[model samples]
Target: MLLKRLIVCLDVRSKRVTKGIKFKGNVDVGDPVEMAERYCNDGADEIVFYDITASAEKRPIDIEMVAAAARRVFVPFTVGGGLRNVVDMRHALLAGADKVSLNSLAVEQPDILHAGALAFGRQCIVLGMDARRVGKSLHFPSGYEVVTHGGRCPTGLDAVEWGRRAEALGAGEICLNAIDTDGMRTGYELEITRKIADAVGIPVIASGGAGTVEHIADAFSTATADAALIASMVHSGEYTCSGIKKELAEKYHLPVRLTSN
Candidate 1:
């Protein structure tokens, strides 16, 4: 079986890595390139650099800044945020991004995914869906609803249905980020993650609310996610990627890297 990965997320804003609680009250952490190198040296399976403010700020990804972060990491890196079209996608690739993730733009114009997948391989494209817990009353017949534009706008689209559409559009992976759990570090929303994972054939990376190693183990075992994306826990120096991997291997006998972090 392919081993599940532990991904470190660098939420970059204005070229600096930052962390936030519940997706608000952002705090500066360090330089993006510097942090990327640190995580790589610390044995992260992969790194995801999200220009957290790109969409909200209405601008393209800072290519120079992206290049800076990409240069520091030897492992695969994924870039997202502020990417609106094929041109932006190409630029991110040229900046050393192994994969490009789309969120706001994909929700606004889904054709972008198809076009990107055609230009780049399906494996090069990832769909990032930010979902919130809608009250049982708000749950439409479709499934759980997803919000976009940094969770400020409700798309009213079912999260599971959206995952299916993204896969059909040739996205090789889905990053299902639960806004409700973001930065809370409580644990992953297993039910929501499983819903998205079961809806799509491609790999699903669970994001948001990972405070303990047991949460990581529970996500993969119960939710069947291909990987877990962690932010605050790692960013704040609570645990490195290797620390989490060790717990996964010890408790579940899951295949996780034994490298140093």
Candidate 2:
């Protein structure tokens, strides 16, 4: 069995790690570089840094911050937000991000996905999808629409169809974040997660609404997700990455990398 991964996400705005509910009322949490190092030490498998305002502000990502976090962590790190083209992707990688996640830009110009994959290899390209449940329509048969600009804009694209297209365009992985459940910590939107996971061959990382250990296990087993992206639970100092991994191994019988007790 493949070992399920536990990834910690740091949503940065104005260079500080922040957390919000449904992408609104965001408040600064701490320094992102310090938080990344803390999570890495807590045994997180990977770290995802999203410059939450970069795309909306129409500016470049904080490459210096990415480099600072990369210097502090030993594990793989993914960076996203404000990355528009192949040149931006290359700069992110050069600044120490193992992968570059594309969302709004990918939706606007899909060919960038093909270009980035060809230029940097598919493994370095991650598709960050922010999806919200919408009423069923001809355009959105799945009733899930892709949202961008930090969940402020909605594109009529169906979430599952977008996942398929991203995979076809050479995205090595997809991070599916549910707008409704973000920071709520109730659980993942299993339906949409499973839908995208089943529709795409690449690994799907379920994001948003991971409140408890059970929720994490459900994402892996019920949703069939390859990884879980956590923010509030870890960011609020309520749970540790090692603790979650232990629960998954002992209670859920899920394959996870356990640390020495």
Candidate 3:
């Protein structure tokens, strides 16, 4: 059995890690580099850093910050936000990101997805889908619409359909982040997660609303996600990656790497 992964997410703005409820009213939480290092030491399987304001500000990701954080962690590091083209994706990889996540830019120029995958293997190309619950509609059969620009713009694209399209376009992984559940800490939006996971062959990482160990375990069991992205739950100092993995391994009987505390 493949061991489930626990990834720590750092939503960075102004070069500082930040967190917000429903993608609004974000406040600085800590330094991205420091947090990445801490999570890596705490046995997090991976670290994801998003330049949360890069798309909204219409600028490139802060490469300096990415390089700094990348230097601190030994695990895989994924970076996203404001990547406009294949060149930007290349720059992020050269800056030490093991994977480059594309969102708004992918929606604008989908060719970048194929181009990036061709330029830097499919495993390095990740499709970060920010989706919101829009209720059932003819256009969105799954009742979830893809939102971009940090959840401020709705693309009218169906989340499940987009996941399938992206996988066919050569994306090796999908990070599904629910805009509605972001920072709410209730639990992951499992219905949409399971839908997308079943639609695509690539690994799916469920993001947003992870409040407890049970929530993470439920995502793996009920949603069939390969990994879960955690932010506020760990950002607030309420949980540790090692602690969560231990719980999953012991209580949930899920395979996870065990590290000595």
Write model 2 residue lDDT over 56-152, tens digit each, in one string: 7889999999888778988999999889788888899998899999988899999888999999899999999999999788999889999987677
Pairs of colliding residues, candidate 2:
none
The best-first sequence of candidates by lDDT reads 2, 3, 1
- Give stretches of model 2 more than 4 Å off: none
Which residue runs does candidate 3 get wrong by more than 4 Å?
none
Quote the RMSD, in angstroms, for model 2. Answer: 1.1
Candidate 2 TM-score versus the reference = 0.97
> Which of candidates 1 and 2 reaches a greater lDDT?
2
Off by over 4 Å in 1: 136-139
Native-to-model Cα distance after best TM-score fit, residue 115 in candidate 3, in Å: 0.5
| Poorest 10 consecutive residues by lDDT, candidate 2 | 148-157
lDDT computed for candidate 1: 0.87
For residues 125-190, what per-residue lDDT tens digits would candidate 3 score against the true structure?
Answer: 999999999998999999999998768899989999999999988899999999989899999999
Q: Estimate the lDDT of model 3.
A: 0.92
Residue pairs of candidate 1 with colliding backbone atoms = 42-261
- Ten-residue stretch with the least lDDT total in model 1: 135-144
